[model samples]
Target: MNQHKKGLVVWIGIVLLLLAGALLAGPGDRVETVQETMRDAVLHNVNRISLLGLKEVNPGLISAFLVTIILLIAAALIRIFAVPRFRYIPGKLQLLLEQAVGLFDNMARGASPHRFRFVGAYIFAAGAFIFVGTLFELLGIQVVTVGGHPITLPAPLSDVNAAIALGTLSYLVILSGGVAANGVKGVGKTLKEFSLPISMSFRLFGALLSGLLVTELVYYYVNLSFVLPVVVGVLFTLLHAVIQTYVLTMLTSMYYGEVSEPSPPKPKKKKQASSPAEHA
Candidate 1:
């Protein structure tokens, strides 16, 4: 376990090294301070919004959304068209996915057999959303705008990232489902259910954002030597990535656990005797 974790850290370091090399340069004046970028993002993207004929067009959000949608489509297409019989992908990928699903299903069943479906549905949705977010990061799509001058919000209805949309949709589902199931009594339970996904998304975004900020700050001030920034940045970014994945998976388990719990069966009413059934 320790060795595996260590390897993951090393892998993260490599990724961060690559990302930093691409985003941050040297001690030259061309370097932009984290504060400056943040200020630009915040000022340029506060509450202000622009709309065009029922369409919203925020460049950053749109980029993220489009990339997310495209990736989802590609994944779908691959699943539908590319994935072949047992001869296609080596045993590894298929085995891993099957094992994961089995493990999750077993865990969920332990909670309640009836709830496994709901939990599985959520796990699928959340996984899709996170996968999209990861792709956005890889593609260098800036979902959050930090500094520009006066901040402005993008189109609300049209340009929302997968995470935000997933979180919002889950919240609504929980809220509505809980209400219908138990009325006001289920509100708290439903909210708790909703938080799993919302927190997962926020936790991920926050970790990545912090890593980004720290990397930028280091390049701005410390003026570190070669390879050192790479090492540190990689450390932080990988930490963020791992933490995010763990949190997401854990929440998925929790949701599945909850939904799987079985409700007690209702007792059937006893019929009244009619004078020994009229001597029947």
Candidate 2:
């Protein structure tokens, strides 16, 4: 009991000291107003990058490329170094990998039992991309913009374009599955749900953007910038990562299953019996 009381008192003292220090410190050269900060969070400044002679690119695009490269490299390394050493009694790394793969496999099977192989692969890839891409922001890797300003690379999904592209790509995959299973009839079925891409795009964009905006808001104020931003940013990012990944993958698999279901055969018509008078 005494130790607990001592620990609490020590923590309170440290917090008081930090609060005093923050109160004494001046807001150093903050020219941007709260509105400006919020605006910049939504519509990033003219910090564009030129790629392959293309001018005025969003930083989120760069972040997407970075995340893609990272995932590709990691996959290559794992394939080269990890797969050959699998044992009947699994080790930690192997167990972890198996569990992750099994999760999507089971989900796909449950949702699209008729054609789950492709759906499982597609959803697994999509979920990994989303979950990893959202967490990428936590790295705090900074890149220099065309305007010579250093800005942290935001999550790819936070950008509207990236979200739309992912959503459209998932829709295309679902459409292809339908076409493969049911042909023209499947295409007609898939086309009926035209708003899917839009809803998916905005869902990802809004969820990720909310986290980014909240983090930016927290860091904008000097008083609250001490330890609160870290906790808030991490919690928001982690929550968004898990929730968005699961939501997108689940929706994709469900829709894919629905569209790709085979059509039931038409019942054979029964022959009419001849009347007794005609037979006589």
Query: What would the per-residue lDDT of candidate 2 be over residues 107-210, giving only the tens digit for each residue?
Result: 99999888999989999989989999999999989887776777788898888888999999999989998999999988998999899999999999999898
Tens digits of per-residue lDDT, candidate 1, 1-280, equal 9999999999999978865875586455543456675543323333223343354334445544565577579767758764664354447766765665665466545543444565555555455445444434333433332223232222111123434564566555445444555556456666666556567545554554555445545555644645666565565445555555445645555544443334456899999778966988
Residue 176 of model 1: what lDDT? 48
Give model 1's TM-score versus the native structure: 0.56
Task: List the global CA lDDT of all models.
Answer: 0.51, 0.88
Residue 85 alpha-carbon offset, candidate 2, angstroms: 1.2
lDDT of 2: 0.88
> lDDT winner among the candidates?
2
Off by over 4 Å in 1: 1-33, 40-60, 87-90, 99-112, 141-165, 173-188, 191-201, 218-225, 232-235, 252-256, 259-280
Give me the runs in candidate 2 sitting further than 4 Å from their true place.
1-17, 270-280
Best by TM-score: 2
Candidate 2 differs from the real structure by a C-alpha RMSD in angstroms, to one decimal, of: 3.0
